[model samples]
Structure formats: structure tokens, C-alpha cells
Target: MRKNSMKNMRINEEVHRELSNIIRSEIKDPRINPMTSVVAVEVAPDLKSAKAYISVLGDEKSQKDTLAGLTSAEGYIRRELAKSVNLRNTPQIRFIMDQSIEYGVNMSKMIDDVCEQDESKAKSREE
Candidate 1:
């Protein structure tokens, strides 16, 4: 059997926490929704770049606007990170919208509708 070696998950978790704090407190962009959360962070082995998955609790337009705001404020975010974390090079931050939450909500609704239909059919059969 072969074992797979991977980058440190703790590093990724630390980065996610620090980035989330920087965005919420340091970044003064009003376009960003307060409800925005950092869902996950993936850092390359070389640590040159990081992709941040964000979940926004709002409509599609708000999510799009929030992403745009984050993209434009990337430089400021990176600078703030330098003061907090010591690294040879600050990884570039990329914001991506996470739709799993929305997908799960839709799937739950579909399942509820199917259950209601089954109950209605059962009642009619009894009548």
C-alpha cells in the first residue's frame, strides 16, 4: 500500500481564519456583505496563491457585488496580511462563490414536495 503525502491542513485553517478576520475588520469596502463567510481556503504547495471559497447569505446580485468588491480590495488585504503573518511572499487571494448551500436548499425543497405528493396520493387511495 502506498501512502499519500499532503500539505499541512493546519496551515490552511490558520490562513482561512486570518484572512476572514482581515476582510471583516480591515477591509472597509461597503460593497461586501457583512454576512459573507470564508468557507474554505486552498493553498498551493509552493504557497504562491490561495483560492478562497466564500458563502454569501444573500441574493445572487449581492454575491456578485461582494465578489467584485473583494477582487478590487485584494491589494489592501494582502498588505494587511503581511503585518499579521510572517511569510516570504504573500499568497494572492482569489474569491470564489460557493453554491453548495443554495443547491442543498433546493434539494431539500424538492424532497419535501415529493413527500407531500406521496401523502396526498395515500389519502385519496383511502377515500
Candidate 2:
């Protein structure tokens, strides 16, 4: 199947949803922060492997610990995914830390700060 085929896209979405559910509810690892979320999932066209982009809402240490925990639980997660989604081959999940959400939040805050500064300067000039 082609990489961007409809079937492949469906598979990717299904896997992404299931992975999010599994991570949010199934895993019991202490190191994983409660605020952790699956940002996105990319399954290979051949279904041989997948990349799960994880986002943790916490400090750097928490994020690192969460990734380590997920890495160690890869086998279990794969097994769960297999049971939840019927597929010929359950893709090997590679946990990747996604920083896009955090980056966007920081950018938004910076923009707000700049806007506030500009408004304050305008008010001062008006005075």
C-alpha cells in the first residue's frame, strides 16, 4: 500500500487513538507523569513499525522519566495494541518526545508579553 493511501491513513488514526487510550489508562508505571499524552502516531505503510510522539506536561526530568518508562514497557504496549487492533503485524512502537506543544505555548506567551509591552508603551505616550 502507498504511504498516504486511505487505508494507511485509517490505520494510522486507529493506532493513534488506541495508543492514546492505552497510555492514558492501561499503563501503571510510576515514572510516567499523569499529564502525559500521545501527541501523534505514524505507522509505516508496511505496518512493520510505528513512531508514537509523546508529550508530557511537566519538567524535563519528568519527561525523561516518562520516556524511559514507556521504552521499558514497549513489549507490553505492543501486546496490548495487538489485542486491541486486529492487524497482521503489530508495529514496533518507538516512543519519541514531541516538543511542539510546549514550543507553541512558549511562543504564545512571548507574543502576549510583547503585546502587553506595546500597549503599556502606547499608554505612556498617550499620557
Candidate 3:
């Protein structure tokens, strides 16, 4: 299957949804923060391997710990995936730390600060 083929896209979406559900409700590792989320998932067209992008809403330590927990539980997760999704071959999952959400929040805060500062300066000038 081609990378962006309709079938491939459907597979990716199904995998992404199932992964989110599995992480949210199945895993009970303490190292994984409750605030952890599966941001995205990419399954290879051949379905031999996959990459799961995870985002943790916590400190650096928590993020690292969550990633480690997920890494260690790969086999279990893969098994669960196989059970839940009827695919010819279940992809081997690789956990990846995704910082895009955090980066976007930080950038938003900075923009708001700048806007506030600009407004304050305008008010002062008007006084």
C-alpha cells in the first residue's frame, strides 16, 4: 500500500484511535502520568512497524518517565492492539515524545504577554 493511500489513511486513523483508548483506559503504570495523551500515530504501509507520538502534560521528569513506561510495556500494548484491531499484522510500536502541543501553548502565552504589554503601553501613552 502507498503511504497516503485511502486504505493506509484508514489504517492510520484506526490505529490512532485504538492507541488513544488503550493508553487512556488499559495501562495502569504509575510512571505514566494520568495527563498523558497519544497525540498521533503513524503506521507503515506494510504494517510491520508504527510510531506513536505521545504528549505528557507535566514536568520533564514525568514526560521522561511516561515514555519509559510506554517503552517497557510495548509488548503488552502490541498484544492489546492485536486483540482489539483485526489486522493481518500488528505493527511494532515505537513511542516518541511529541512536544508540539507544549510548544504551541508556550508560543500562545508569549503572544498574549506581548499583546498585553502593547496594550499597557498604549494606555500609558493615552494618559
Best by lDDT: 2
TM-score for each candidate, following the candidate numbering: 0.86, 0.98, 0.98
Flag regions of model 2 displaced more than 4 Å.
Answer: none
What is the C-alpha lDDT profile of model 2 across 68-88, one tens digit per residue? Answer: 999999999999999999999
Model 2 accuracy (lDDT, Cα): 0.96
Candidate 3 error regions (>4 Å): none
Report the Cα lDDT for residue 21, model 1: 99
Candidate 3 residue pairs in backbone clash: none
lDDT of 3 by residue, 1-127 (tens): 7898999889989999999998889999999999999888899989999999999999999999999999999999999999999999999999999999999999999999999999999999999
Q: Which ten residues in a row have the lowest lDDT in candidate 2?
A: 37-46
Superposed by TM-score, candidate 3 places the C-alpha of residue 66 at a distance from the truth, in angstroms, of 0.2
Candidate 1 accuracy as TM-score: 0.86
Q: Could you give candidate 1's per-residue lDDT for residues 59-97 as a string of tens digits?
A: 999999999999999998888877787766778988899
